[model samples]
Target: MEVAQVLHMNGGMGESSYASNSLLQRKVLMLTKPIMEVAVTALFSTGATNFPASLAIADLGCSTGPNTLFAVSEIISIMIDLCKATKQEPPEFQVFLNDLPGNDFNTIFSSFLPGFQEKLRGQIKRKDGAWATLPCFFNGVPGSFYGRLFPRESLHLIHSSYSLHWLSQVPRGLEGNKGNIFMARSSPAEVLRAYYEQFQRDFLTFLECRGQELVVGGRMVLTLVGRRSDDPSSKECCYIWELLANALNEMVSEGLIEEEKLDSFNIPMYNPSPKEVQTEVQKQGSFSVDCLELSEVNWSVVDTEFNPNVASKDGGYSMAKSVRAVAEPLLVDHFGEEILDEVFKRYKAQIADGMSKEKAAFVNVNVVILLKKIA
Candidate 1:
């Protein structure tokens, strides 16, 4: 499958859109805020005396919505505060928001930019209390980050959140992974190897490409879904997919979806362990891992926080919508648009039942890493 063409969060501001269901992602960003602040502070402190006139920043996998400019806004706020503290002029900002070509860049440019600019202006003020022109420019670059997306050494800082778990394409040699849409307990050993190998290849390419784009002292803050255990089939990462597969299988049995289609389909995603990520960075040899940490967020808890009304009705409803916003486009591409409603309906029921039986929170494991280009 052409991941760039098919892999995108559901767009528009409807009820099921990513824009509405991305509170989970926003929570992840908030969780990593301290790390991001430190990374930015270090970048400036290393070159406190000689600052660039223009600062280049990129946000990879920046899907449209409220979360689109969330991190960039925080970074700019921190930078502006740092400038004030040091009595130095803040540099002109060239911010590149990146995602696949299919991403809804229109929403970002038309709906978000105006308010974002106004908010920035309000934050940046001169000594005489007049608004200072920070000269922040916004550009949307459409492409996969696994490949070259920027000119050599053009970026000063890069931030990616809740991306990178998506592989560039489905792993080759997954024929044995029948009845599974991702890494699962029932998957064969070869299936496990295939997924890991694919992650390694994609991640190394990501490192190599970003290494060429970031300046010598540039830093990167990346947060993505991950697992704590070395076992690829661990529940923290694989259980959600397994539950999803169960829902699909029920459809196949009921003649709603073809069994062959189910067998052929696999989500082009893998949640790596911290070790796996560190190993790839070491192998790539382009950047040093400054900080790597793992954290888990209970889906039920997040739902309660963000969608209390819906959560009160059915805990699975909100979580289901969140997954649908991210996975619907891919499902539509593979299964045709006909099965989406039934698929997610069954999937939601499955999640509700699974959560009840497990008695433990349904959590998404996340890995946050800080990297600096080797100078």
Candidate 2:
């Protein structure tokens, strides 16, 4: 893989969206409540399958932040609830947080250690009357999710989020010399094909790993972007890739840049559809879908013209701005930080202020799917 692509995720910089997403767990939990109800019910009802006095749990792609331990916490909360209902022993959880090798293990371990210790003490008090215990022995396994990251049937429940859409590579066949149909233009057949192809490959691998890690009756949740192709537009946070595209087009119209460069730029993100996602999950053949729902939580209502304008106020930063926030940084890594940060700052300001003046768009897509390990 190219260095630009490798650095695209901002390895070790502690500045990726994952680091800043404090609301990710709450938002995810909110969107997942319905599915959780189903999964938890199935687990509890299956003859009250009692876990170890301590349960083993894992969070995949546990990015370097507070959100990684959520799977463990959530499981603890639910298991406690189940204990009350069934009057059976609650499982003491042995939590493992996993991520890529380059992940911020120090930060993750530090943040969770203090709280983890306390939780362990609490567990002892609850179960044995007095306290003085090593909380749920928390540890880190830093590695990619593409292959086995745990012992067979080692985890009772597994959780992953938002990280899966990233394909290992920009889809091939989009390049002209590669002889696929995608040319330097928007909506090219080959462009989308390559994108979906990568998605399919990676998504299936995710399900396969999930299939492997989960115990026979265990369940998992997946949340990702599911878009409506006809809409062809999205605006989330202060970052609006498509709207910025329109601004760039405006700059081009005013002779600021050549039109030839348009196709060279893309959103650098992929939003798959619910149908497409279902197709991939079904293809994996190891999990059965228990719930499928979509929420436009990241979406905001914007001026109607934002869709058709394609060359004026797209309600976000201009392509010129994005060149700084994204392209510039990718080209000159060390020098591009200030430039990208400045560009994003301005873009953010524009969204906040312009939205006050106009309706602004909402670009949230929270897809919550609960899958049972049928394999």
> How well does each candidate superpose onto the true structure, as a TM-score?
0.97, 0.74
Q: Which stretches of candidate 2 lie over 4 Å from their true place?
A: 1-21, 47-50, 119-135, 176-185, 228-239, 243-269, 298-338, 353-360
TM-score, predicted candidate 1 vs. hidden true structure: 0.97
lDDT of 2 at 84: 63
Task: In angstroms, give how far residue 46 of model 2 lies from its true place.
Answer: 1.0
Candidate 2 least-lDDT 10 residues: 176-185
Q: Which regions of candidate 1 are displaced past 4 Å? A: 125-131, 359-361
Model 1, 284-314: lDDT tens per residue? Answer: 9988898999988888778778778887788
Model 2 over residues 1-375: C-alpha lDDT tens digits? 342233232223243334342342345556666666666667767743455566677777666555566556656666666766667666566777776665667766666557756775676577555324433667788666767788777766777776665455556665531211122224456566666677788788878887888778787877775565532222332234443444445545776434555444443335677787889888889888878887754323222322336224554433233223223434243222333454355445655565556543445566667777878
Q: Candidates' lDDT values, in order?
A: 0.90, 0.57
